[model samples]
Target chain A: MLNYIWIGLILIGLFVAVGNDIIDEVQNPYRNGEPFVSTVLLKKAPSGIRQTWEGDLVAPPDYFNGFYGTQRTQEPIRQPAVISKSADGTASLTMNITDASPAWWREMAKSAGSKERLLGRVVEFSVSEDQTSARVQVVFESIRFVKLKAVTQAALDYAAIAVNIALGLIGIMALWLGMMKVAEEAGLLQVLTRILTPVTKRLFPDVPPDHPAVGAIIMNIAANMLGLSNAATPLGLKAMEELNKLNPKVGTATNAMVTFLAINTGGLILLPATAIAVRAAAGSSNPGIIIGTSIVGAGCATIAGIAASKLLQRLPRYKKAMEV
Target chain B: MGEFLKNLVEVISFIAIPLMFLLFLGWGLIKKVKVYEVFVEGAKDGFNVAIRIIPYLVAMLAAIGIFRASGAMELLITVLAPVTGLIGMPPETLPMALMRPLSGSGSLGIMTELMKVHGPDSLIGIMASTMYGSSETTFYVLAVYFGTVSIKNTRHAVPTGIIADVAGMLAAVWIVNLLFR
Candidate 1:
C-alpha cells in the first residue's frame, strides 16, 4: 500500500508540475520584459512636514551587475537619506509613486539554498529605514508572472529535508529516549499507567484484566500526552509486543493492537513543544498561543480514533476474528 | 485572562523540565534501578531506531517534496477550496492537512513554509501550528510500528487513523477560530 502511494504521489506530482509549467509558460506576462525595479521614491518626514524625493538610478543600469541597482562602478546608486520624527508625532510621511512598469515593482522573493536567484531575486536594501527614524517605505506597482521555478526546486528539496531530519533526530531521540529509559526503569511509567488504568480498561476490552499489556498501553498513551514522543514510541512498541504475545495469529494485527495504534496515531499531546519552537523560530509574537488549540484538537482526534476503532472492530468481517 | 494563562503556562514549562529530571533521578534511586546505566541502555536503542527508519523517512520525504512541487498540491487545494473555505479552513492550509498524516517532516516543512508566507500571528499561521500539533503522522507511525513487528495485514488501522486525522483537522480549525480569531 505504501509503495503504491509513493509511486502515485511521484507520478501525480510530475504530471501536475509539467502541466502547470506549460500553462505558466504560455500565460506568463513577464516573459516579454526583463523584471526590473529601476526607480525608487524615498519619502522622508522632517519635523511635522512630510517631504518626498525622487531617487533616480543610472538609466538602463546593468541588471546583471548585482541587485539593488548597483552598477559595475560599485558606487552606491542612491545616497542614504536621514529621517527624524516630528515633535508632535501626529503626521506620517508616505511615498506615492505611480509607475506600472513591472521592473519598478520587483519585490524580494525567497529562494532555496545560497543561490536564491535560482527562483527569483531577493534585493537587499541598503537604505536606513529604521523605525526610530522617519519610517521609510517603498511604493512600486508592477506585476510579474507567478514563480513556477520554486515548485520544481522544492520537489527535489526533499532529499535535503530527509538529510536534515536524519541529522536532527540523533540528539533529540537520544536524550528523550534515554530519559524515558531511566523513567521506565525507575517505575515512573508504572505510576503513570496506574493513574490511567480505568480509561485503558474501558478502551481495550480485549486485553484481559490484570494484564501487563494494559499497563504498557496506558504508559504509551501517557507518554504521548506529556508530549514525550521519543518515549512514546518505545513504550508503544513495547505495548505492541506485549499485546502480540496474546495474539493467536502472528502476522495479522489483533483487535487490541489496532485500537492501540489508532489512539497512538490520533495523538495525545497535552503540550506541543516542537510546534511552539517552530513558531518562535519563525519570529511569532506569541509562540505558545497554539497550546490550547492543540490540546483541544488532539482530544477530539483521540476520541474519534477510539470511536472509529470500536465501530470498525464490530463489523461482520472482523466479527469472525473477534469470535476466534 | 489570556496573559495570565500564558504566564502560568510559562511557569509550568519552566518547572516541568527540572521536575521531570529530579523525579526520574530520585525515583530511580528509591527503586535502586541503576539510573545511569539504564539511561545509557535506552539511549543506545535510539541509534538503532533512527537507522531502522532511514529508508522509510527518506522515501516519505522525497514523495512529499515531489507532490508539493508537482503543482498537484495547488490543484488539490483549488479543487477543495470551496468545501474547506466553507468550514473556515483556508485553502493555503490544505497541503499541511493532507500531508500531516503521511509524513512528519513533510507536514512540518509545509507548516514552516506556510508560517513564513503568512506571519505567524496571522489566522492561517495559528491554524497551521494547531493542526501540526493536533495530529500524529499516522502513516509514518503505522509504518514504523508495524514494520518493527512485521505486521503484514494491518486491517482497519488505516481507515481508523485517517478518520482520526479528519477529526483532528476539524477540531483544529474550530478551536483556533474560537481561541485566536
Candidate 2:
C-alpha cells in the first residue's frame, strides 16, 4: 500500500511538471543587455580653484527607450553627483562635510522613490583642462547608502538553478528511498536494525532498541548525512511519526526524538560539486573556497549539533527518562 | 523571441555540449546500458519534480519580482549600510545580496554589472563575488524541500537555514577583509 502511494506521488509530480509552464519560464534566459552611460559636466574657474561639477547616470538604456523601443523624455535617474574642480589642474580639491548630519540611505531612498540611492561623499577631484570642457576625474571616497536589491536578485537566480538541480537529485533519491522501503517491507530494515542494535541501544536509550522507530531514525539520519536534504526530510518525519506511534500517551518531548532532530539538522556533508558549479556559474575567479569552507563549516556544525544533543539529553527530564 | 532563441542557443552551446560528452564517456565505460530507457526515465523524473514544486516556485518567483518591483530590497540595503560599512563591504554589493535569494541568473546579471561598475578587483566587487559563491537560497530550499515532502512545519528549518545564511554572509565579508583589506 505504501509502495503504491509513493509511486503514485512520483507520477503525479512528474505529470504536473510537464503540464505547467514554470520550467519553461525558469529555463528561459532573459536578455538585459542595455548600454548604460554616465556623464559629468564641470566648468573650470579661471584660477582653477574650483567652480561646479554636475553628473547624471543612466542605467539600463532599454528602460529609457519606451516599450516600443522609442526614447522617453523622463528617464530614471540612478545616481547624481555634484563636485567642484580645483584651481590648478594638477591639485586635488577635498570637500569636508563633517558638520553636516549624515542621513541613513533608506530614509533618503524613501523620499527619492527608488531602491538604491547614490552613495559617496565627495572627497577630492582631479581636473584636466581642454579647449571646450574641463574634464575632471571625481573620486568618491565613501558611500552614504547601499542598496541590496541587485544582490538579492542575483542570489535568487543562483538559488533557482540550485533548486532545479536539487529537485533532480530529489527525484532520483525518491526512487531509491522507495526501493529501500520495499527492502524494509521485505524485512531488510529489521535485519539492519538488529545489526545496529548495540549502537542504537547507546544512541537512543529512551526508545526500546528493538523499536521500528529506531530503524526509521537510523535510515533517516543516513540519508541526511549523504546531503540529500529533501530525501532526508520525509524519512525523518516518518521516523518521528513512528516514534509517536509507540507513545500511547504523549505530553512531553522524548530524548531520542530531540536528539534525532538535532543530528538531522546538523548533518555534516560536503557538496563540493554544487559549490563549484555555483561558483563557475557566478563567474568566480576562485571556486576552491567552497571546498575549504564546507569542510570547516560542516565540521563545526556537526560537532556543535552532537554536543547540543548530548547536553539536552542530560537535562533533568531526559535524565529521568533515561533512568526509567 | 529572437533574444530567447539566442539564449537557448547559448545555453545549448555552453551546457549541453559538455554534458553530452560526459554522457558519452559514461555510456562507453558502462556495459549493457539501456540508453534510451535511462534517458526517458531521467527526463520523466525531472519533469515530475518540476511540476510538484510549481506553485511554490511561482510564489517565490513572484515574491521576488514584487520585491524588485516594490523596491523593498533596495530599502533593505539602506537599512544594512552601517553594518555593511563596519564589515568593509562595498555598497555596490547590495544588489547582488538582494538578487541571490530569488534567482541565479538575476544574481549573475548583478555580478556582471558590479564587475563593470567596480572593475572586479575593487573590495566590494570581490566580496560580492565571494558572497555569491558562499551562500544558498534558504527560502528556495525550504519551499522545494517542504513542497516535495508535503511537510508544513517550517518552524525550526526556517530559523536554522537563515542562521546559516547569516553565517555565510559574515564569512564572505570577513574572508574578504582578511584577504584584501
Interface RMSD of each: 4.0, 12.7
Question: How would you encode candidate 2's per-residue C-alpha lDDT over A1-324 as one tens digit per residue?
Answer: 212323433343334333332333443211112222233334333344446554432234454344323443343433344554345533322322221212322333332323343233333344444422333333322322122333334336644754565456556545433433443444545767899999888777768876777877777765554445554555564466566565434533345554555454443444424444544555666544444444444444444544566665565644554332
lDDT of 1 by residue, A191-304 (tens): 776777787778877787466677667767767877767567766766776788888887677888888988898887766878998999999998988888888898899889
TM-score attained by model 2: 0.43
lDDT of 1 at A258: 83
In model 2, which runs have C-alpha deviations exceeding 4 angstroms? A1-174, A182-269, A278-286, A297-324, B1-65, B92-135, B144-157, B179-181
Place model 1 in a CAPRI quality band: acceptable
Which stretches in model 1 have alpha-carbon errors above 4 Å?
Answer: A1-4, A24-188, A208-217, A229-252, A274-289, A316-324, B1-5, B14-18, B34-44, B92-96, B102-126, B176-181
Per candidate, native contacts kept equal: 0.69, 0.01
Q: Residues B43-130, candidate 1: write the lDDT tens digits.
A: 7866665555556556666776777666686688778888987888888888889889977877899899999999899999999999
